[model samples]
Target chain A: MGRALSLAVIFFLVLLPLGVGGSTLFQLPVFSQELVQELLWQSWLQSAFVSFTFTVGLILAVCYLSLWLGQRITAGLSSSRIAPLLAVPHAALAVGLMVLLSPSGWLVRLVHSLFELFPSPPAHWWIADKSLVTMAVVLVIKEVPFLLLMIAAQRDQLPIQRWQTQAQSMGYSVRRCWWLVVVPALLPRLKFPLFAIAIYTLSVVDIALMVGPNTPPLIAPRVHEASLRFSDLASLEAWLGQWLMIVLGAMLFVVVAINQTVYRRFGLDAIGRPNGHSAQRICSGFGSQLLLWLCGLAVLALIVQSVAGTWFYPALWPQQWSLGRWINEWPYAWPLLQNSLWLAVVSAAIGVAGALLVLERQRSQRKKALAWLPLLLLLIPQLPIVLGWQRALGQDAGWLWLLWSHAAFTFPYAYLVLHGAYISFPSRWLYQAQSLGHSPFNAWLHVLLPQLRGSVALAFAVGVAVSIAQYLPTLWLAGVSYPTVTTETVSLAAGGDWRMASVYALLQALIPVVLLVWASRQGNQQRWKSKHVRN
Target chain B: MLEIKHLTISKQQHVFLSVESLQVAGGSVLTLMGPSGSGKSTLLKWLLGEPLPDFQIAGELWLNGKQRDQLPIHARKIGLLHQQGDLFPHLRVLDNLLFALPRKDPRRHQAALEALEAMQLSDKANAWPHQLSGGEQARVALMRALLAQPEALLLDEPFSSLDTALRGTVREWVFAQLKQRDISVMLVTHDKEDAPGTIISMKELTHA
Candidate 1:
């Protein structure tokens, strides 16, 4: 199983690229002579490498620093207690950040309105500039919460009180106990999550497209545009761009591996709380409050931006608000909304069912492949891999193919959600029913299904969120002929039309909200039913 | 040294647990008895002043002649142990003992050693909490609490989960040590066998 899964991965990376290259090489008009040179210059692959290195390094440093500073102030932070940040989709966040930080962004306007001290931005502003700093900033803000959540989840499982009280009793403050005892223990467990964040940073497409440099964007986005939009398989340059991204992705794997080896050898993250930013320290201390503020502010801006029919910079609020556009938008917007919801539901159902089946059966050495594949899927540059499939399949057979690809991605996440709960579920209850002469299937249906319904509901909601947030697959696989909330939002956002982007963002945010609310209600019902049974 | 006056903990205008008045002078044990779901744990939580947010608490609690209800948790001069004994499962028994004292105290290690020796758990000093038997966990939890030198300790069925053979030995030792230290204690239990001195049933308290 391991060998087969590994071969499958290798085939996509190696053979598929060669296949695309060969096809382009043989094609008449699509293969341009200067494609490689154009890629080196226009694609900004070198600049992207520099920018990626800066963003990944700074974000990793900030993440570790935030954890240390948070541990210093208090040990109260835990992953399960994080704010609604979990539910706020990634594309939604990037759009929000764009609205806040753009040259004509609300923050710039707000400052201008209040103080009038700062000069207006030049025609060519730094937000999404060639430097890519704005993208870096947004990436840090988004990834910080994720790292905090991941660390806190594992940390909570450790014996916090025993360690805290033991250290505090010996004349140490709460901060000391957390730093000296708790942090060292948490570091080893945090290795994979941090790696996930790094790969995520490297391979991220949506955020980079929204706030990153366009003339020369992140490698992932470059692959996305070339293969998906250009649609000229004869374009050897596009295929060449895809190949370059795959190499960069390969380099990231090496970087993470070497970092791991060096870490284990020298124990670099083993000690010392380096002083991070004081403001960031306060933000970490406030914990959920900070997350809520960022989310709330972004949401409020999106709402405002959506409604303002005609509004200029340096205005605190819209001068005029109109429902006319909203009414006009609904006809065009309704279909996208319906498609996104139905697709999410269909994909989530299929994804969760597949997860349940995979988890239920016992596998031998194949389980190791299962473990590696999900993280591999997570770390990989998604667009490059999909370009191979699109190149292979030739422009998306139908919506069913889109649904299938979305489920394939969504399966890992849904499986992760159900896995911990499924494994820990009491086998005794199922066994006891079977011993009483009920068939195995009946016992499972009667005992396990009801018990697992809550997890299934939650997993289903997560699967939907993953689907709704998808940008490239829906755009590339379904083709622009079929639109989802994410595709509509990004396209409008890229066009510099805040009003239309805001409407799509609201609808995008709405789908997840509806699913989560329903999931939560299902959870409550399950609890109430269990209690009623006991009574 | 521990007093709970006019304590009535209510949830959404529905009373869950209430006690008009109660006091345990120094060197005494007040055993609180009740069946499951009868709010025995609720009463202990209320007395410790960290009751669930869902419940409304109205009361005055004084420990060692000071009003403690308004004090922060660490400064309440009160200690708590639950059914599982709640030993810092990650720490060794010795480390757990040392956790009771501030690090600056030069005698913290020695004090921990002495305390373990007195409890006749000297051999298990380096053992993790999970390595110990239920009886040993209870003893360690109790010793850890006492070492903090709390004016009062609220034990919520601390000994009920222990094996029958080890219960009597640990229970007798616990009562004797609290009396020797003059630390007031309230032990909430369903067992009649655990009555150290005066036993006050929770049902009786609610009626009063």
Candidate 2:
């Protein structure tokens, strides 16, 4: 299973882009060329700054918030709940939020229906009112859980208790220890994921297209518009490339500046006795609970909207509920769902297998030449590399190319999650297995794998979540010709019809939500089962 | 003065440490010695900090004439050296020592260099901790704690990871260095011979 998955991943990574090239590359290159070449250095530079500032600001805010939230969550709740919450798709979340915010949305529709007593919808635009608020909110909701999960994972490895105690003994307060010691250590490890989130937020097309300012939408959506519209493909590609370069440069500058500020403020020692907060009530337990409750509410809202038959606003619940949308969409949804499932499953399976191989190889090798390889996918922004790979491959058709594209995205997360679990496995168990004369594979299967079921399940679940959330790869490599739920949802959302769009958006989120729910239970069950087995 | 009174610690419902009383004044040293699993380390952890909550601890601890029982670890103005030289892996030896200095200390780099010179390790200032010999890393860890100018120091088998010959030398150097600073020292060890001051044997720990 491992070998086959590994081979599949390698093959896909190498061949898929090449496979997709025939149609998009040779047959329609001229049509797409103008879209690809439109580079306005001034506008590109301006948006780059916008994206850089927004991204940096967002990451720092999230990092600070993570410091606070991580402490509260660990002190209060179990990490088991985190996975299910994190498993929700970014696109579906943006769509749901757009629903709540758009004037014609559930929010405004209700206002018009209840307050004005209007029999018909209002002509005025309400929520996404030419502001970045909707986009920013969507990004925060989508990104925080990921940052939190990464921190939780990192915390599992750190000697948090011991260090906290030592810091306290040294006259550092709990808040200080967290700020000075924990945050610094945790932040650096988290930088990659945080960067990924920042880049994704800046470059997100689907979400931005759904709710971001339209007339002159964000750079990503504009690029998409340019390509699909065919009036200016070359200009779009140059604009994208130049915007990428500028954004990357600006991001680097801001990241450095913030890093310096953090270093100067916190100093060399990450652990310090923190000064107590005079105003600690920014978000209380009640507020966080509310935030979590709202996140739950968001999921419920989407799930409910996915099933709702037409109902006007002001009602607390949808007046009608049916699976007619699911029924009508099944034939279309089936092939797409199958494509999505196979994509997620294949990508996840391959990613896990690839990660394991690299880890095992690293374990056996005396020299650590490419220890940073797995981190590349995790840390580097996907926009440039994926685009470059697409250009390099020249395009082809086949599952091979599609699978490869997904692997490029999935493998890093798989490596990070699985590598953590692999390293955390007690050496004594392996020693015992060796002493028992068990071969490495048998030892892994019988001793290590069984013990690592929780971590493995968690890693696999995370891998699935990441693959499911992929918008770029599914669109880019699949040529937007194949209508995966993500592609369909994004396209439908582009057309500006909330009711029908919500249906596709919710459908896109369904499998991953189910997978996440299952993964969470499976993780807990595996953890429980392992304990029983050991006992 | 450093005082720990009627301190008790339990892990998974099993009592690890139940010390009745222990005290060390300015320029004094207290050695806590017991067999492995007899709560010697647990007592050191209680005095310094226990990062995990797997254990329940009941205690009153005073440091430098202040009631520090409720003070968090960093605010307690205490420093610790563990069995492994837990130097920040990413930092050079000088920076590792420099990291322990107070934020407002203008001469942190100079102080760290001086500390390295005192340890006869000035040449290794730019070297990573892993690049240093085990004995050298031990000296750096010792200097890092001392340079912080901690009011008190706890040594949880700081020299335990060394070879026998190196262990004796590292222990002698460590205790001497702490003594030179007039810092109160609390040492926890399985080996009684390493104790330099009054020993607290928890073999007869009472039910507090």
Error of 1 at A227 (Å): 2.4
DockQ of model 1 vs. true complex? 0.01
lDDT of each: 0.68, 0.66
Question: Which 10-residue window in model 2 chain B sums to the lowest lDDT?
Answer: B44-53
Interface RMSD of 1: 20.5
**Model 2 chain B, TM?**
0.90
**TM-score on 0 to 1 scale for chain A of candidate 1:** 0.81
Model 2, which residues run further than 4 Å from truth? A1-39, A75-78, A104-131, A167-173, A229-236, A239-243, A246-250, A253-284, A319-322, A363-371, A394-396, A526-535, B1-208
TM-score of the A chain in candidate 2?
Answer: 0.82
lDDT of candidate 2 over A81-115, digit per residue (tens): 56656777777777777666555556665666567
Model 1 spans with C-alpha error above 4 angstroms = A1-48, A58-62, A65-83, A118-131, A165-192, A228-234, A258-270, A273-283, A361-370, A419-455, A517-535, B1-208
Q: State residue B193's C-alpha deviation in candidate 2, in Å.
A: 17
Per-residue C-alpha lDDT of model 1 across residues A1-535, encoded as one tens digit per residue: 8579668866764467346645646565645667556757764576457646764585557556546544632213322223245556776776776777677777778777778844564366566422377767666666665566555445534678788898878866665566567766666555555666666666667767776776546666665665545455425545666666556666665665565455445544453345434464455557646655777687787887777866765677888987877798999999999989988999999989877776776221123112545445555666666666566655754788888878877786676656555655544344323322335576466567766676677678778888898877787677566788888888877676667888888889887766665665655555543431221
